[model samples]
Target: MKIAPNSRVLITGGASGLGLALVLQFVERGARVLATDVHEEIPDSLRGLEGVSYLTLNVTQDVDWAKARDWVTETWDGLDYLFNNAGVAAGGRIELSEMDQWQWIVDINLLGVARGCRTFTPLMKEQGSGHIINTASAAGLIHPPRMTEYVAVKAGVVAISESLFHELKPYGVKVSVICPTFFKTNLTESLRGKDEQANKSAAKLIDKAKLSADTIAARVIRGIEKDRHIILTDRDGKVAYAAKRFARPLYYSMMKKASFQMAKKD
Candidate 1:
């Protein structure tokens, strides 16, 4: 599970945010990397990096996975790590979200990770060594109010990653799940234009919350080196998880109180 200097790695959704941070870190660590996003135009800064390459990938499609696999096999001869980090964001309570919104987010966030594992894990298994990293969320561990669909999908990611970890162990593949409270990323944009009023209100609340992308990336790299099963990016995340585990009734009571306050205001 150690990512050696010359390891070949592929990352989905590497065009920006956390994926971009991972690509930068790995490239600096001496890994040869191929990154992809559904969006065209890889960032100019990353274009000239010697050991890194970029491509357009729509992770929801089987054909896209095939092309990514072909590209890595042709370029690197084999793959050492497949980071299933591509994701989309959605904002709204379950009842408020449109059906298409639910479908779109789940397809891209949850099922996309599943598809990546399905198509690429075998390639690594055949080679006798590889790693799979799935990006879940702190929301995955606890279903907070107002993020029903997102929380559910992320929870599924954690479950899928844990299952893959055990299943892939027989094949010498490793699986890790990342759960961060909130890091500065384009995921927030998923709510953009969906519901401007509610989004602005949420934005104000988020602006008061403090977390950094650079810090999260650093932690993730370290976690990967250690082959951690569940990588937590924030101190608050660890604390929150522990609190929820040992004090379930208190946690629910506090959450219910907060919900009542919000409702009373509404």
Candidate 2:
């Protein structure tokens, strides 16, 4: 999984956010990237980038994934890395969160990653050398209140990556799950919920976060280079995971306090 020059990489959700960040970094490193997003036309940021091609791919659709798989197999012959970075955010009190909303997020966030893995895993297994990096969130590891949909799907991503890690290990393929906390990104473009206040709170955390997508991408690249299984891209995320692991009482207290604060805002 060394990201060498001319490395063949496919990234989903490449129009914006961490996906775009990874695209830019990988391109700068001289990798050939097929940066796929939902936009029909090329995204402004990727319009004229050399060594990067834009492909319209909605991760939720089976047809789109089939097209991607064919293109990668025919054009590049094989892929070096598959970045399952497409996802959306959803939040609300459990009772207020509708079934449809829950299903929508599950389709895009959890099943989207699942589809990517399913489609490309066999390709990698055949090649015997490839990497899959999934963009799971810190919410996956440490669940807070009011983000059940997001948390559930992200935790699913973590589970998927961990399972694939052992499954693909013997074959020389690598797997890494990125569990990043709030960061500066446009991940909120897809945010939705019945609770406006709770939705805004979720968006605000991302808006006010200090770490830039590039910084997180850099850390992720490093982690992938070392073949790390779980990558916490920020200090807050690392501490939270640690707190939840060995200090359960303290972690529960902190989450409870935060829940009350969110309730006050609501």
Candidate 3:
């Protein structure tokens, strides 16, 4: 999984946020980068950049994945890296979240990665060596109050990627799941704003945490080069993950206490 200069890479949701950051980093590293996003326009920073191409894509759709894969095969001949980074954040306790909201979040955050990995793996398998990076979240490891939809989907992503790691190992392909804490991104806007009350408090909580997209992208490149399976972006995320793994009951009890404290304050 060593990304030598001029290696071929494909990334989804690359118009902005961490996807855009990864695109810029790979392009600068001299990798032939193909990026896609639902956004019709390319970012000014990536426009006219050598060794980079942008396309419009909706990761949730099967047709979009097929089209992108075909385009990559035709244009690049093969892919060395595939970053399944498209995701959307939605907040609400499991009992309170709307069904449509859950479906939307899961479709993007979980199913999107699943579809990408399913379709793209065979293509990469042909090349005999490739890497797949799926963007998960710290909340996937340990859930907080609210954000149930996002947390559940991200958790599923981690599970899927972890499973794929073993499945693809025999093929000489690698899989990496990026579990990052709150990063400076527009993911907060993807929350269910139609239900303002449920999302307002969740937004405030997310705002208090600091995780920069630029920093996350740098770690992603390093992890891909090292062929690391799980890439925890924030040091805090690593610690939190360790705590959850060792003491699940204690970890959740502490969260419950914090939820009561926040409710009391409100």
Q: Report the lDDT of model 1 for residue 254.
A: 67
**Overall lDDT per candidate, in order of appearance:** 0.83, 0.92, 0.83
TM-score of 3: 0.93
The TM-score leader among the candidates is 2
Alpha-carbon shift of residue 124 in model 1 (angstroms): 1.3
Model 2: weakest 10-residue lDDT segment is 197-206
lDDT of 3 at 233: 79
lDDT of 1: 0.83
Please identify which of the two predictions, 1 or 2, would achieve the higher TM-score against the true structure.
2
TM-score of each: 0.93, 0.97, 0.93
lDDT of 2 by residue, 139-258 (tens): 999999988888999999999999999999988888999999999999788888898888788788889999999999999998988879899888998999999999999999999999
lDDT of 1 by residue, 1-266 (tens): 45689888898988778888888888888988898888778777578887888888898999888999889888788888888999877765445678888888889999999999998887889999888999999989977776777888999999999998999899889899999987667666666335554566566655565776667877998999988999998888887788799988877986788677656754
Q: Write model 3 residue lDDT over 55-120, tens digit each, in one string.
A: 878988999888998898899888888889988877755667778887888888899999999988
Ranking by lDDT: 2, 3, 1
Name model 3 segments beyond 4 Å from true: 193-198, 205-208
